[model samples]
Target: MRILRTALLVALVVGVSVSALAKADAPLIDAVRSGDVSVVRALLDQGADVEGAAADGSTALQWAVHEGRAALVELLLGAGADVTATNRYGVGPASLAAENGNASILERLLDAGVDPDTTMPGGETLLMTAARTGEPDTVRVLLARGADPNVREELRGQTALMWAAANDNAAAIHVLAEQGAHLHARTDNPSRSPGRTFSSTPATGFTPLLFAVRGGHLDAARVLLDAGADVNDAVSDGQSGLVVAAANANWEMAAYLLDRGADPTHAGAGWNALHQTVRTRRMNVGFGTPGPFAAGTLDSIDLVRQLLARGVDVNARMTRNGIRDGQRNRFNRLGATAFMLAAKVTDVETMRVLLEAGADPLIPTADGTTPLMVAAGLAIWNPGEDGGTLSGQEDEVLEAVRICLELGNDVNAANYRGETALHGAGFRGANIVVDYLVEHGADLTALTEDG
Candidate 1:
């Protein structure tokens, strides 16, 4: 049986002529590497596998296509190279050609039966990949070649349009939209599985609207909004696009959403935008970013003022995380009045804004921490020359102390630690603030366990 099998192999080799078959075997590799049309033609004439691959899993046609050798690519295709043949990682010849900017080669491969919708390991389709490069022409070619505009990868839930939108690829987005891509399709599954967290979701779990608002594509957000995409669709942790827009300081987008009835007061937002801005600024802590919050131009303090003007609770306490037994939609234990938040940041404008809007400075916190206590503590804890206004630092601290007095705060008010604002100033060596506190009837004799 071994002898018979050997004889059959010998006969097959002889039938094709050993030299001719040997030449056919490696000819495609040589032709692509050399970009030579005649060698490619000879190999095809001798019945070589026109799609023969190198050790790395790239085919002869892939090499020719990637090199932009139009003639060799044509010859290989005519020899029946499988255009859709994927590399080890599933990147097809058309994708390889697209990667190298060989559009002509891409066209030839597509014409030779490459599937434009072929996906990579993570379910990233060719169109999604192309959109990531921000190449409008490649995107247009793929769309025109019948790639489904709304096709989504199962793992990531990313559509081609989503990729374009997330990358801020305006032209590609325009082309994909014109080609009928579904803008509303979620690019990532927010509720899929524990394995598919917001961090793990494909393309950031961002919808077209979230991408638009976060990426500063106000125009795109407007377009999507007009097309009937829900303005209030919350994805991760119940954070809506409006929330992202507000968090990012993209005022135009926020205003746009607000105008379209997007509630500035979103679920899971510990406080409204205005209150958050005030608290973050006063504490010298940003909402998420670093530095004193500038309350950038896009912030709708005006809108907040308007809400307050209409009698929305200016002194409302936000349900923050540090609070205890907080009922849903009700003030939590750590909830700070608008005035408390304002005093912490020492933004005179914010203070003025809240006060004008009817926030009562007299309200004391659960721990007996008043707005004055918060301001004095912030002034002491916040370090450096830029901590606050140097010239009026003492006066500002003193003024808060005086305001508390006027508002009927206890003359010797103490906090959970039994520390008054005076203790904070004296321990920190803030002579000016301490002097002001003492002169304004702060209890010099008050002593906590630390004192």
Candidate 2:
């Protein structure tokens, strides 16, 4: 009878203790979530496990950091919470705190001997994540905590400073550089090239400054340049910083890079920076659809001047034969030289800028079309005769022709088909252009082989 009573009492005591522990677990997490510090302290004193993970495999520390509860985070850390604990997404406390710019929480975690360079599953360290966040505070704090600024991510092998430049975060860039981040580290991601990133067209690899220029972040680009980034670094596709800037028509960055001694004449895949800027100038508006007018015309002209000042050949032709008249909408692909590209622009100011900078007006493309012929054809172009900008286009074309003539381009230059400017002007019975061509010294009797 004594043994039975003793066994029964011990079993009851064990059951009550298990019940208390079970009761303590639920409220601890609840307290942390509700930001009830007192309740959390009480549960901790009552023998609740500090590392109790929630359903998402995240502990109270993860919750506190994610909720941006700095005070709660401190309390939890003091209670022996694991600073390196991550949620289901592999996002750890340090990454969360860095993203939130929670400096105090970060400091606490670091002081507790948590590695400042702790990264997620994708190899995104605290510094890389914070750099792209555009807030420099977290970046600075992490650097002070001994985060490696030169550490690369898994996918692109890009460093923290490169991520900042890629996202156009100037403030973050400033902070990272102040702590000795590398400026010219190149990406080594194979997936970025040869359609490996899940598409047919390949991607361009980048340096930190290349990303800044590609993103059109003028201030960020300037910062990178000042940090001794190489202006002439090229991608796997051989595109330099100046070339990318010109390709995006980022005239401001282009000009600044040019001033910083970036090569203006550097060509990639047969297209030079000068030729790319002119290509942008030459893209025509769609028929009968109003489009945003091309902006930064004056900036473009200034960029051209900078290129000329750099001693780029005023008549540098492409290294490869042009792609012309394909189903890819390649027509009048006079992408051969800056002057010929100016002819395709049909803008008087662009033509004037090129001519003033010593771009020859009479240069014929491989197809033998001249600025005079291109102007005459565009002047009489009637987009269904009902397009709203028809009058403006006609005026522009006429002005383009006048500018070409004033620049002394040959009036009688013919193409590979033996077709003169009149042939282009009189195409599809465009008599307005034919009459204009006739008045401007184009011979009417000139004919192609078929004619």
lDDT of 1 by residue, 121-181 (tens): 6666678767755678888788789888788866657677766666667777777877787
List the candidate 2 regions with Cα displacement exceeding 4 Å: 1-34, 39-59, 78-80, 134-137, 144-146, 168-171, 178-180, 193-202, 282-298, 321-329, 332-335, 373-392, 401-431, 434-451
For all candidates in order, the CA lDDT equals 0.60, 0.67
Q: For every model shown, what is its TM-score relative to the native structure? A: 0.67, 0.72
Q: How close is candidate 1 to the true structure, as a TM-score?
A: 0.67
Q: Residue 354 CA error for candidate 1 (Å)?
A: 2.8
Return the clash pairs for model 2, or none.
none
In candidate 1, position 279 carries an lDDT of 38
Model 2, C-alpha of 409: deviation from truth (Å)? 6.0
On residues 13-69, what C-alpha lDDT tens digit does candidate 2 reach at each position? 432342433543556766777888888888889888888865445567766776788
Instruction: Pull out the clashing pairs in model 1.
Output: 282-344, 282-345
In terms of lDDT, which candidate is strongest?
Answer: 2
